[model samples]
Target: MDIVLQQMHYCLTDDASNWLVIAISALLVVLWYERKRIKEAIKQDKTH
Candidate 1:
């Protein structure tokens, strides 16, 4: 019983870490896209 509980705890921790990594990756992608868009807008403003 103790071994089973330990295994379950390990699995939960692993899953949580995987989810955290995915969430951070998604956030970085969004930030990168937004930065690109802002730069384009600034370029257009300067042209006009």
Candidate 2:
């Protein structure tokens, strides 16, 4: 019983860390995409 509890705890923490990494990656991608859009907009304004 004790071993099972320990394993369960470890799995939960591991899953939590994976989720954190995924969330950070998603945020970075979103930021990068927004930056690209802003740069394009700036270039268009310069043309006008």
TM-score of each: 0.93, 0.93
Which tens-of-lDDT digit does each residue in 1-48 have in candidate 1?
999999999999999999999999999999999999999999999999
Candidate 2 residue spans exceeding 4 A from truth: none
The TM-score that candidate 1 achieves is 0.93
Please, what's the RMSD in Å of model 2?
Answer: 0.6
Q: Residue 41, candidate 2: how far off, in angstroms?
A: 0.6
lDDT value for model 1: 1.00
